[model samples]
Target: MRAAICDDQPQALEELKKMLLRIPAVKKVHTYSDMNNFWATLKDGAYYDVVFMDIDWKQDETGIDFAGRLQEACPYTKIIYVTAYTLDYVEDVFLNHANLSGLLKKPVNQEQLERNLEKILREQSEAEGKLLIYYQGSHIAIPLQDILFLESRLHKSCIVLKKQEYLCNEKLETLKGQLDGRFLNCHKSYMVNMSYIREFRGREILLEENHVIPVSKARAKEAKERFFEYMSARM
Candidate 1:
């Protein structure tokens, strides 16, 4: 992941940069002692996946204020606050901004940094709703929430996403395991993502895009029970 870091202290900036470089997931990192330079680089179309910003500094605008502007420029960029101040002093302001990924205390160790980075990256991936699926010679990340259902076609699997059907080599059981609680095995040959369910007509389930899937007689009772439970949790 491409990253950017800004801290007024030169030693702190170097330490943070060294720690980030050790992380295998971090592809590139840009460090700045001046917030203006950092902001200017981002504004010039420099792409960064994550940014480690220090909140407390003797600057005109604090990191919290800069974060708000960063959100306006790149809403998808993840901002992790590295602050010496207590969260009590920052939480109120931090809560106002979206895409606030993590809050780390000063003198952070390698373990703490790794743990926070793992959580932030995982949450970022999930928030994007992408699911990794591998096919014959290639792999792809399909948006889980956008998938309507999966159908078993002979020896191939058909993923009903949006209004498109893509073929996969995996079976129904494999797909079910890869998916989260949002998908239900409504039939022996079909699995439906609950988020796309529009209605249930007897043994047939209506999904988004006017798609219909069958609910086996034996599984009908269990399906309804589970679906109701899912809806209840959402409510």
Candidate 2:
């Protein structure tokens, strides 16, 4: 996996980078002393699978704020906060709307770093499959990772994606049977891809692309429980 490290402390940044390089799973590692340089690299179309961010920036902007902006530009990039103030900033980091993968305490431990990396890699592997459906006149195979949610519409199910939708002549229950744990049946008529969920607002779920999915009153509690379980497993 390709990775980036953003930290103002030179020694800390290099230490993290060196540890990351030692991991065989990590193919490339980039270090940045300034947040501007990191943003500039992203703007230039550079992509990293994960970014190790420092929560406390000495400047006017904090890492949490910068991470929010980074999510806007690259929604798929996973963020891992590396900080000494884990207790102080932990709440804020999770509260923010970012694709957070995990967190690491400062003066990083090699074992903890590897565990986080392995969890992400395992998730990516699990997400590597396709949903085959007959759409229009041809058969379509949509990557499971790209799907946002599935909505039941009368006799058909609408497979919603980031930029496209497909009508499949299958019942929501039948489709749900084929999906993995990452897909949650939050409502009787809706099954959401947990990876695309931005927030859970009681009766409604806010998706990454600004789409909203209703949560049935009866299933709201289960949805919240499953979502938290999913998050905890990854962390």
Considering every candidate listed, which one attains the maximal TM-score? 2
Return the TM-score for each candidate structure: 0.53, 0.57
Show model 2 residue runs off by greater than 4 Å. 129-141, 144-235
* Per-model CA lDDT versus the true structure: 0.79, 0.85
Over 1-235, each residue of candidate 2 has an lDDT whose tens digit, in order, gives 8899998999999899999999999999999999889988876557777899898889998888988887766555679999999999878988994878888998899999999999888866665587656676555678888899999998678999889999976556556644788998988899999998899997999999899999999999989999999988989
Over 1-235, each residue of candidate 1 has an lDDT whose tens digit, in order, gives: 7788988989998999999999999889899999879867765457677888888889688888878787666555678888888555465555765467777888968898888789877865674556555554455778888788889888558988886778875555545545789988999899899988888889989987888899999999999898989999999
Model 1 bad stretches (over 4 Å)? 127-235
Deviation (Å) of 37 in candidate 2: 1.0
Model 1 lowest lDDT segment of ten: 169-178
Number of the top-ranking candidate, with lDDT as the measure? 2
